[model samples]
Target chain A: MRVELDEPKCVAAGQCVMASPEVFDQREEDGVAILLEERPGDELLDGVREAVAVCPAAALRLVEE
Target chain B: MVVGASAAGLAATETLRREGYGGALTLIGEEPHAPYDRPPLSKQILSGEWSTDRLPLRRSTDLDGLDLDLRLGVAATGLELADRTVVLADGTRVPYDGLIVATGVRPRRLPGDGAHVLRTVDDALALRDRLAPGRRLVVVGAGFLGAEAAAVARGLGCAVTLLEPAPVPLAHAVGEQVGRVLSQAHLDHGVELRTGVTVTAVTEGGVRLADGELVEGDAVLVAVGSLPNTEWLVDCGLAVGDGLICDEYGEAAWGSPRPKAGGVYAAGDVARWYNALFGVPMRIEHRTNAAEQGMAVARNLLRPEARKPFTPVPYFWSDQYDMRVQAYGYLRGHDEVAVVDGDLSGRRFVAAYRTGDRLTGVLAVGMPPKAIRPWRQAIAARAAWHETVPTATPAAGARLDGR
Candidate 1:
């Protein structure tokens, strides 16, 4: 699975990090999401998908390969 | 069976399906429409930025795939715990093997006409239609909902008067210091903020204050707090205070070990469960908690023997104009509040709420999630205040990024 995040649109609700902390991190200067892993295995797919879904601002997107 | 087909109810249903529960699933909701998210009702939907079609929590195709027995436009009037049956408003009794109550709260209406409350999509659309450009809007409460509505109204070119009875608006929720900062934000945005006064009556022309002062307005938005929908469970023998009392696992707590045969659980704004992280019981009304707790309750229902405690560090966010205020953990009963980063006057800073030496909560306005993420972790870990602080520089290179 591939994760794509639009940092500019992020309101930094922290729902992404709460869901998939291993794959996602927020910038210290701003709360925009920072992708730690662009491509994660099947184990992290569920959390990454949830992070994309729970985003209030719709900042995160997951592209299935 | 799940009562109330909003976020919590939908989440529980989805989780049950995901967890391989093949049993008969029924979702009962009072609203005629399908499950939808409520956060955008006051902001995007009211401001005319987003369409009503975007409000549904799940698409029609996804909901159809779930194969749920959806009973819309019907309300659950009573609960028969002994019989494992739910009494509907239309005098229909629906039996259930396991019950999950997600009946959310309703907006507390003011005792008069000419006032509107935004809780559901219908309420939002009605309020949006009335909020034309150059209309005088008087918001009766200064809570998050009221503040968001006032902001939306102001954005739509309405003259807004945000009236609050407390000395500082949102002081009870976000602490006095942060609340004052937010109150100032509203004033800076040209909102006529009136504090230390109570509304006596809602007149035809406008609202009359306790001191006999009348604030004239074309429209009135009552944003007072909400009350949980727990009247249906009064005879169920479940402990109901502000909401249904439950354990961390979301099981209906009757003070002692269960003598009952059937299972009854609750989530979202309707469930008040003991939070082990905060050492207190709380019924969180936020959207995130509703989703998370609903999933947790579903898992616990499936596996009663291996029940995991649902102890989430409560998080909530509010958008007012260009400012985004986000907070995590319990801020109540905190003695000290320190601005760990940024200047409060600049309207871009992060503050740490502490009870003695332990970190209780973190509030950030315009501060990035990366900066606030560590504080939430510290709160969840129950770390000491000093432990959260990094080096001797204190505020310079003390970012809790790694260690």
Candidate 2:
């Protein structure tokens, strides 16, 4: 799964990091979400899916391959 | 089936689709519009920075992609748990294999028809059109929604008078110490802040306070909390109180020790589910929790064998003027608060809440998102207050606004 973080929409609420630490992290300067691992392993899929779903800003998108 | 198509209800439907549920699905909502994000209604939408068209939760094509038997503008009247049927206002009884109730909440209004409450898009627009540079705005209840609306009105050039029954606004929710910062924010922004005052009646022109004082204004905005939308479930029989009582798995709770029927679940502002992380029952009205809980309930419904307790590190944020107030974990019932970073006088500050040794919650004001991220981790890990906060942390309190 390829994870993409829409930097503009990220409110820096840091929900993505909480849901999937391995796939996403927030920037220290402004709190925009950064894709820690653009393509995560299958083991981390569940958390990544949650991060995308729960991001209050609707900033995260998952591209399934 | 999912009822009340707001944040939680919409999220549940999306998750069910994403999780490969291809069976006949239904989405019901009382509002005529599709699901939309509400956090921005008091801020951007009210301020005219964003238009109404930008509010939909998803594009129409995306909603259509879900292949839902979408029912909009239809209100749920009652739930027949025994028959697994939901009676609607349109005289239709829709049956579902498994049910998810996300009716959310409605704003509690003052005992009059003259005032406006900001729960829906229409409510925001009506208030927005009335607010002018010289017009007076009398706001009842100094809660987050009230404060945010006051800020917006003040920015729009309206003279705002904020009223609260408590001595300090938000003292109960953010603690008396941290509440000062918010109270000060209103005063600093040229708002007429009145505390320890009550509104006994709403007038066509203004409001009558409990202490025989009449506060006149061009408009009155009532922001005094909300009541869960549980009137429809009066006979559903799945334990209802401040919200729909649910087990740790988000399933509606009934009977003693455990839920008798697991087919029904609740989420969002309407669900008072047990939080395993905090070991207590809580119904959070925040935006993020609503969406997260919806997805959790959906997963638990689809995969009951792997159903895990919905244990979330609750998060909520309110944008007031230039400062953004953010918090993580359960801030309620905290014993002590420490200013881990920033000072009380300044706009930027981070305060940590401790209930005994454990760090129960954390609040940040005007701080960057990165500054508050670690605190969420600390609260989620249930880290001890002393371990994370240095011994020199100052107590969260006020040195200004002598009241």
Candidate 3:
């Protein structure tokens, strides 16, 4: 599974970090989301999906490859 | 069964399916249109920058793949807890082993019609049609919703006049120090801001102020406030005041010194749940809260034995022109506000809110999310204001506004 982070759309609410801290982290200067693993394993899929849903800016997307 | 097919309701259903709950599920909503994100309604949606089709909470295929018994265009009029039945507006009484009330809130309106209150897409579209170049927009209630609409209208070349009963636009929400900073964004952008004014009604000419004066405008947007959609919940046994009262676990409860409703829960703007994090019963009306709380309820409802308390540090954001306003934790009822970082005059700063010693909230204007992200953890950790807040301590020469 591949996760995409649209940096410009990100408002840096840190919801992604809260939902799945291991999979997603934010840039310190601006708070834009950064994907730790662009392609997360099955075990991390749940958290990744939750992060995508809870994002206030609707900045994250997941693709099943 | 989920009673409101919006964010909270949709999130609850999604979590249930994601957790491998293959049982029968029903999603009910009053609006005929499928679930869509609301935050954009006042932003690009109202400005005609984004179409309605672009605002779905999730793609249609993903939503339909859930195999929900989709009941749209009908409202859940009555919820009979005793019979374990939910009576619908279309005369269907659906039973449920577990139920979630995510009916959410409706925008509080002024007296009379023609004026707009934006809670739904239709409301935004209706007001959007009236707003054009050189049009005059009289906005009542300088809250986030009102301010956002005003910004959008102004961007579209509408002459915007924002009215707020409070001296500062968001003084009641964010303290006066921060409110002044953000409210200035409107003024600098050519918005006529009238503070400390009570709006009586929507008149034929425009908005009628309490002082027998009419603010003439081509269009009026009443972004005053919202009330929980808890009328149908009346006489249904669960305590309903400003919102449906819930325990820390998001279960519907009776009253003060309350008893829990075992299988019935409430989430989103419609719920006033005990936030053990802040030791307060908070009913957050933000989009993020609705989604997060909905997931929390679904998790607890599935495994009541392994339930976790819904102690979320609430977050909210509003985009008005170039200024991006974001906040973490609760701001209402805060006793102290300290500008820990940046200057309000620059329109780029962060303000920390505290009640007693505990840090209750943080407000950041035009700062990067990363700058405010650490504060979220502080607020969530129940950090002390003096120690945890950046540059807000005595050693840092903090100027704490007791107001």
Best by TM-score: 3
Model 2: DockQ vs. true structure? 0.66
TM-score of chain A considered alone, across all candidate predictions? 0.91, 0.92, 0.95
Please list all clashing residue pairs in model 3, or write none if there are none: A30-B370, A31-B370
The digit string of per-residue lDDT tens for model 2 on B1-403 reads 9998999999999999989999999999999999998988998899998898777777788789899999999999998877789999999999999999999999998886789999999999999999988999999999999999999999999999999999988877778878988789889999999998989889778999888788999999999999999999875677889999999999997744332455889999999999988888999999999998999999999999999899999988888888888889898887777787888778688888877788888889878776787788888898987798777666454222211
Model-by-model lDDT, in order? 0.85, 0.87, 0.87
Please tell me which model should have the higher DockQ, number 1 or number 3.
3
Clashes (N, CA, C under 3 Å) per candidate: 3, 1, 2
TM-score against native, each model = 0.92, 0.93, 0.95
Q: Is candidate 1 or candidate 2 better by lDDT?
A: 2
What global local distance difference test value does model 1 have?
0.85
lDDT tens readout by residue for model 1, B26-116 = 9999999999889889888999998988777776877887789999999999988778899999999999999899999998876678788
Q: What level of docking quality does candidate 2 show? A: medium
Per-residue lDDT, model 2, residue B268, is 99
Model 3 achieves a DockQ score of: 0.60
Better of 1 and 2 by DockQ: 2
The list of candidate 1 runs beyond 4 A from truth reads A1-11, A22-40, A49-65, B255-259, B389-403
